[model samples]
Target: MLQLAWGLCLTALLGWDSAVLAAKFRRPAAVFPLPLLCAAALLVYAGALPGFLRAGVWGGVGALGALAVWGALRLGRESVRQLTESSGLMLFLGGAALLWVVLFCLQPMFFQWDEFTAWGLAPKMVVQNGCLYPAQPGNLKASFTYPATSMVTVLFQPFARWSEWGCMAALDTLAMACLAAAAALPNKRRMAGIAVFAAGFVLPYFFADTPAGSYAAQYANAMADLPLFLLFGGSLCLYYALGGQGRAYWLTVLPLMLLTLTKDICFAYGLMAVFLIGLDLWWAGDAPARKRFLPAVAKALPLAVAVVAAFVSWGRYTAAVTPLQETAASVGSEGLSYGAVLLGGVRQLLGIGREEKFAVLMSLMFRAFFTRRVCLLGGGAAAVGCITLAAAAAGCGAETGAARRRVVTAYLGLAFCFAALYLFHLILYYYNFGESEALALKGYDRYLTPYYQAWMLVMLALLGQGAGSRRGAGALCAVSLAVLGIFAGRGVPAAGFWSDASSRYTLRQDVQTKAAALNPALQPDDRVLVISQGDDATRWYYYRYELTGTVADGFSGRYTEVGDTSQREKGDFMNLVSPDNEYLYAGDCTVCTPETLMAYMQETGCDYLLLDRSDGYLQQAFSPYFAGGLQDSMPATLYRFAGCDAAVPFTVAAQESGVAG
Candidate 1:
């Protein structure tokens, strides 16, 4: 089964990439994936392509780091004087490489909870069905839990390989590597700027890799989201990297279509990227950009499938997770801050905020989307970066045939989009989060928007060509280093994660650790169910989580769905634990085990039921049928619920009057 899984994933991945490669090789192409071959090679060298394909967070970091080091080594030796002149640049590269190594080395240590909830769970479903299929509860996810993207999202995983969250890291890394390579190859002066500033690669890096803090890779590891980030970011870089023509131009559009298909977030950035690409084309010449349209369209055809997939995925998530249960108020109420409000316009354009937060509510009134953490460079630095880059481009305008006006327009368009994405979030407080008072949920920063990096890199590229001086780049390398140093200095010590008081006790433990605890010894045919709240049980593949290294061929499952009407079907519900199964590890959610849950379980003939509600859902306000029966007990204690908690307590009350246990 494992070998077959590898065969499937390898075929799909190779077919997709190699087709493009074969096409590019057919002619003298622009920006070939050649530079990335080494990274791909390293991944192949590490282990079975499927293992990394299944769970390649660490693998990607290692691959990317190794490839980058190799790229630098190919730079040909620099004279001692030249090396000395660029000591700061060399040191920056070395430090970043070191960080990458550390990131890979400690990758296992930092993997977290949500990874299981979002990343790990989806792939498991894909592996089970042996293809992209609807995930049902108690196996992988609730019917509505996975968005429409689940089909391909699942397909992207090595088919027949029962793993979760693994493929997400791999796909995201592909996009990230492409984006970084594009950035590195750009003719901008800030090429070194983005490199040294370190913020340019933030999201793409962390999305495929991992990060610190509660929401660190929490944002990146998400299946659909990080891919969306890469699509948008990569498309933007592709426009600049493509220089308005050649095979690279075609490659740029594929990511664009992908951006649109990934998530609602892409609609905004996709527009920016496409528009920027158009501007690049227009500036390149009157007929040349238009002449390449066929090739671009042809190259982008496969990616268009992503659009169909995204729509299908969106329909699923909307049908399940947010249906009527998630109203404008509930979503809008998720976070309300002034930063979100004032930056409402910014948010809207960047696809970050809701209607309530948009400066003009009607602009995005019809659509509702929850935004993720978008990192970009910040403030005075952002503005100065743009101006300097503009100056550099302007200086070259006469010497080179590139259109300064078009580039500036693209930059400004990017800026406006970001500003809009930010402001939209600020206004969301009043219109969405119900913030009648001053909003303070911290909505309008670079971390929540992409423009920051766009702005930062553009500015840096400009500065590099204009003058490689540190202060000329704003706040000398030392100061910038000090700031990053401070952040790095805090390192693992400050990397702890936090959760709401309700689940704080249960969720605070390292996610992997918590998942490990739930792993039990079992047979090849054994099956398990994890009923968790807030991303608790992901990486629990009997192999990874249990790590008992014992033999087991059991397929695993999860509960919860993405959108509305997205819950387990009777078929999957019945298959929760195969007939020969022995154990189950559960997470918490008052939503589960409700009256409806009891019916589902009894119908499935479940022998044992475990409820490990993180924190305590014990005192939770329940329906009359529930509260009157079930109740809370010791902290972190596992409860056995047969019939119902309500029934047990009710039986106890009746027992006092002579009822049976």
Candidate 2:
């Protein structure tokens, strides 16, 4: 926890000094987010370059820190002024939010599926090995192609030890930074900024079906969704507030770069941001229409180049380090690559021969627009449009017309981008997932909610701009607080929120404890097969990550379905054996028998078998093969295949022994 505090302070200093240097020591009106964006961008590069070079990531971090220190020294008193200029309300709210995050993150466990597989795994690999996932030994099942931007965010500890709480805290800090950026609009009405900030803070709860139980649950895990959307939306807010002035170009480009580095799909959001910047520029200035076109293009050119560069560079890097089989473009069983599948999906979208899957996708997407929780784009746009028009009708000012036009333009632009992104996902899923999973539109909200969240922030920023006077702004602030209070009270329970968050990962914690106890008996070089009956295949990943020594080679459950016994041949199940296999369902077949099980152990070079949960089949059919009659422990059992012959029977022991080994 002390490590987390030090890391947070170091990151804050680096971010602030870097932003100050970038701004040439001159304070901007919307000062809070520039540092946040700068820090995120700096961390992305600092974390990434080390992986590409196979060097210590902390060395790169140290270099960045030194540079920030130099910049701060040069700025002198200006740095102190920059800190003093930040909004007190924004700071207080952000601090309060960070405190809540720290408490929630103190659980020290990863609850989400993606956390163990990709998001959490990637970072753990980096911190443990001081390099990328490719450099890690054993069969690492994480998506190696996935960018490490989010991974670096949580690397606060100096030692190689991984901390789940630290990861959550670091990421939640980034999220809060984004909210602060969005709220720090360049408006004279301080109350208006407060209102916008307050709204943006509680916006996640507005969604009916959040992935987690409570609002705090959203930030308690180390997933890329929350940070990606917040950064995307915050970039737009900073651009609008700063007006894309002299040093503001760097601010704009840095956040977009961070956005691009966040996830593969987020590159589109960065591109959309670039286009919107150009559009805003085109709408600004009273120059002739013909002259405005080239100038707008010229101004947006740097952002476009930066985004493209980030995207292409990361793509090339991942391609170089990652195997062809591990990539998203890997060929499937149908003799078509994922790229080919995407092209086919595009053809279906263009009115070529369509399938039932395509129809299902279209129906879900169309229906998503009407769904209250999903259609944040439409809902936010409506609210912004209505507010702008109402202000204009009441004779607020001529500024309302420009604000209205900007709102409409942004709405149409984002709506189109959203549709394109949805289509891309629909097609991508069609190829990557099973028919049922694809048709169900799994992770629909998780994927699309980022865009809506970002859109809402932008709408709030625009709304803040159109707020006429201090009186009206004060009223808006009061109303926003009232709404926020009501929603927060209903959405997050005071008594249960912390306890529920802390207790959410009790099962995972139990797994870790058992793994720690069992790890001493296992050798680092040994290939171990784990059997956890009636559990999800994903549990194998949990064991694989938790075990300090030996590799968790494969997993099999007693209740797994084995289709068509007649068609299966002797030793046919051996074909499924691989280091990469997440779960190998060795059903109640020939493989479960003593002789066949011995053969499997011999063939796979596995000398040890761990029964995480023992069942009837193990005791009756396979017990004699155990070298010492089931080396039992609390809640788990181990079997040694070294001494026992397949045909020999050994003494059986009680399964309920309270032994450690």
Candidate 3:
């Protein structure tokens, strides 16, 4: 709770700084997005400072404090008065924040695969070590080049103990801030704002009917996907709401920089935003083409530069800190270089002859856009209807009609951008992934969902923006409520989503509990080998995360060549194993007999063995090696191996009891 409070307080301070800074240049269209803007600024600071100084977390805190002090001095009585007058926006944000707090309390654990491997792990490392993951002395489990924006944003304070819930709450706060910016729209109608917020909030749930089920689940996890899309969509919505004026270039630059730094692939989104911004600028006035071109270039130049600078700086930093081979290994597969695979994919596209993979990808993407992604399709349809009604009501001569037309143009622009982004992913996967995975389009929805969600939010913003009349606002509200009802019926209920024990959340909770129990008996530098029968690499990742301070390694007990000659006939079956698995063989494999197991332990330098689940074969084969047999424990049994001989049961028990005591 203290961590959560600190996070919220820091978020408020940074948000105030952002608002005050923007107010110095031009009055913001609305103040609700200040937190998100500040978050972007924080990312820029965190990403940049590390290059020049190794001050780590203190450097970030110092930046936050400096910004806050500056904002406090600049904050005038008039600014406070303006903030007070915006009571409706304050209440909406407060309510959303409260709900986020409640959601974090209900489930503060990460259940997703990538959460432990990358998103969740990276931030925890930063918080613990006060430096980037690469700066730490260990083999990098997560990709070193993965953007640290999300990780940096979660660092609410320096020297504070890391809390998973706190990090999650911090992330949720950013998302809420982004969505709440919709209230700052020029449309003063209360119903229209509510409709927009409702649509954006429930947009992720719309994919529940598709392969990416349960937005609540996604929300609970600490993956970068949810926050990345929210920032992307929210930034565009705010831009359009502000009428894409020349003065709002700062808004475009900050968010674009932050978005680009959130994920490596997100640079593409930044470029897409730049294209849209340029388009908006071109269509701004009734000036000649020659006159508009220069102005558009001048306005869009800063945004493009910011995105490129951010991407290049982070790339250079990672290259300096990480080995080229490691980065290549993390990104591509089958020993292919990133560039080679990309070029090969392009060549395949150019010289395609009835490409079955291309056909499948197109078909899947079509279904995803038009049919499976009901929320996007429905939201797009509703946006068009609302814009049409607004245009018809206001007539073509009115400013409102022109704005609605621009909205239509923007929607079409976003569709084109989404297509381009999707094509890029398809091409990358075509070369990087295996034939089966590429054909099946594994993780197809996960890859595209963020972009789709972002596009949906933009569409919803347009719908709200065009809700000029009472009747139009009413229709928009009706559509939003209907969509919400469909989400509730088909998706996981928002209220009970966290409490679903049948989900991966429960399994992770169990892993965490077991790790907590075992961590006490183990030393910080202990080398622990985890063995969980019937489990995969994911379980080891959980233990690796939970065991913190200890070196944890493990095998995926799911499959092994063992006594199967047919499987052995397959050349190098180990090549098929996931790189995530620390050890290649299962506990019960033919090569895992007593003497071989001891040799394996020595080879890996593992001093402790944790049987997360033991089979009959494991018990019979290894029990004789332990002098006092396996130390029985809930969820797992611990075996302490000291120089190829098991330690006495009593000594281990005493240490465990002492730690528990």
Candidate 4:
């Protein structure tokens, strides 16, 4: 039912956008891009409008009415028979891809702390309470930095918690479905466009993964990352399809904004969109081009204003009310040998850095072409068979120069857009880190996961062309398939992502079990303070991050001096600095010894003290207010502090609250 409704709503939205672009720009006879891009959006809109109105979305209904006007206009003038027939193949391919993605790769488990902070926890918080909670029952309290993704998720969460995931999934699926339908059109430009989507974003199935194969598997929300990535791509496609201007501009803005709200990574796409539009405006010539460009400018205007305003407001709020701090050691590139960094860069270019990159690339190639994994021994072969249809492009194409240029222009423009986006991130990392391999997570490949597959697919498609005349598309696909199969069989051994889960979850268990064995050492409501050897020990403090008042970190707050402090003085602190009174310890204070923590805790009236590592807390190193003795640091034990000047102002909460949603 939701699927059917979404299809109509999508249709209405796309149809209206197409009519608006055509009416404003007055494209010659028919614009292929407009129809190709706008078709599915129209269907989804048509399907979704009535129910959305009935649900008391007066504003959404108003938007629906406006889109319907455009839908009616487009339908009145443009013939759907050819367009529907033309898009049929792509629609089918995209739907199949959608099914494969939803069933196979996507999962529901919230694996990312980043996602936990932004989406999973935020909506959970918002639905249960009106305003955001500063912190849960566990540790420190401060401002909320959760991004917009939670707000988007929260929209459906209010009705019913169960409906929340289902709503998001259904809408995201519709977006994917539209993307697939758009790709199935019957022209070289259309096919190339489809190829762009295939290569750039969605991963080809890794056999017997999620929905396609087994149910109990590796992921919890395999559905999320891909949907947002495709939204970014399809939004771009829609922009170009609607001629990138006029009322047709809304086609791009609506999706781009929605994508922006999906996650922090996606906000980068919104920035990218602004850049692309600005570039288009600068490059375009004459009235027709201007017509397409201007509406885009207008459409993007609202977002541009809103985004800037929001940033400014948030920036001001943070600066005046709450400050967000970051570490230069982690963020900056200072001490590494530049020469070695350059060598590391060369290693990556030479396929030498981590096996993971090679493994991912190898896995992608196998998945794109063929899967020989034991999990998908039979019918999955037929899915790869569709690659055979793509070969038809070899024989069927525009024979004329003018026709080829149009097709080439669109792709070249898109390629340039991607190149610019990649270089912008790539150079930033290189400029800072020189050539650090550990810098991969700093937005290199992860931010661009959806688009990576496109590059892989294009390689295959180009290869397919070479083999088209002699071996036939089937053989080309089959051979490609065979290559992927072999790679899939061996890729897992190379992907070692869990190298760090060791000590953390396990040591946390040891800590908990050992502490539990010491029965009545602390009551359920009693506060236990944690002092890591240093900030690095926090990695082994996973249970503490959950925000139960039972455990507290002496250093989610406080000053540090363990490592080099050439850049960060007291002036460098970006956040509030109240001593962590709940727990006081000196585990491994490279710069801050037990002496400093004990006195700080004593002055703050903290009740517990723990010590580790035979190092001085630098009582001589700090003022008495900031120092204490750590001469007895060898015995690592948690002890009670009997003498304190005054108690902390706040009492610990009895129960720990789950994330916002």
232-306 per-residue lDDT for model 2 (tens digits)? 888887787665667655667777787787886777788999998888777654565578789889989989998
lDDT of 2 at 178: 69
Cα error, candidate 3, residue 137 (Å): 4.0
Give the whole-model CA lDDT for all candidates, comma-separated.
Answer: 0.38, 0.59, 0.59, 0.38
Please give each candidate's TM-score: 0.51, 0.81, 0.80, 0.48
Error of 1 at 89 (Å): 20
Q: Point out the higher-scoring one by TM-score: 2 or 4.
A: 2
Clashing pairs in 2: none
RMSD of 4: 12.6
Q: Encode model 4's per-residue lDDT on 1-661: one tens digit a residue.
A: 3433343344344434433434455431123222333232333222222322113322333454665576556654453333333332334334433433443233233334443333344444433433332322321222334223333333323343423233344344444433542342233334343343343223333322323222322222323455455555555444444444555455455555555544434556666655555545434433365565666465557766644544443334334433344211122345444356455545654666545644444344334324322222322233234223332332234233332333344344445656555544443355454334423324333444454333234333333323323343444444454535533563232211212223224544444443433324444344555443433443224334232224543433234433423422231101212233224422232233334444545544455533322233322332232122334233333445544333331122111121111
* Candidate 1 C-alpha lDDT tens digits along 31-104: 33322322333332223222333344235334444533443454323222222233222333333233333333
Clashes of each: 81, 0, 0, 69
Structure candidate 3, residue pairs in collision: none
lDDT of 2 at 626: 61
Where does model 2 exceed 4 Å of error? 11-74, 88-97, 139-145, 186-189, 208-216, 328-339, 371-404, 466-486, 493-500, 521-526, 549-591, 598-608, 631-661
Candidate 4 yields a Cα-based lDDT of 0.38
